[model samples]
Target: MFSKEKIILAYTVEKCKKCNLERKRKYQEGDLLFAETSKCDSCDGIAVIEKIFGETIEK
Candidate 1:
């Protein structure tokens, strides 16, 4: 018997250059690359959308 199972998950990456902080979270609507996001938690820095990608995992 053969079975195939896989799941794909999307994610968004945000980074702050001032603090060199990086964050990853689930993908959301209206998210665009290089777009300015919320303030950083570590310091008074602005976080920007760095990248958006997806990964596949076996179930």
Candidate 2:
């Protein structure tokens, strides 16, 4: 019998500074995310990562 494999991913929440609207997205450590360049859905302004949640992969 083979054991089940464990797959991990991370979920992050971002907030728009202009609108205060929050959004959830998949997060990775190596990703180059800048609030200045990233746009928010509600305000079309810069979006910043507010918090990180859920299981993350260990590598």
Compare the candidates by TM-score and give the number of the best one: 1
Residue 22, candidate 1: alpha-carbon lDDT = 99
Model 2 RMSD in angstroms: 4.6
TM-score to native of every candidate shown: 0.88, 0.59
Residues 1-59, candidate 2: write the lDDT tens digits.
87666667777777788998888888767544434436887779787777766773444
Give the clashing pairs for model 1: none
C-alpha lDDT values of all predictions: 0.94, 0.70
Error of 1 at 15 (Å): 0.3
- Model 1 residue runs over 4 Å out of place are none
Q: Which one is best on lDDT?
A: 1
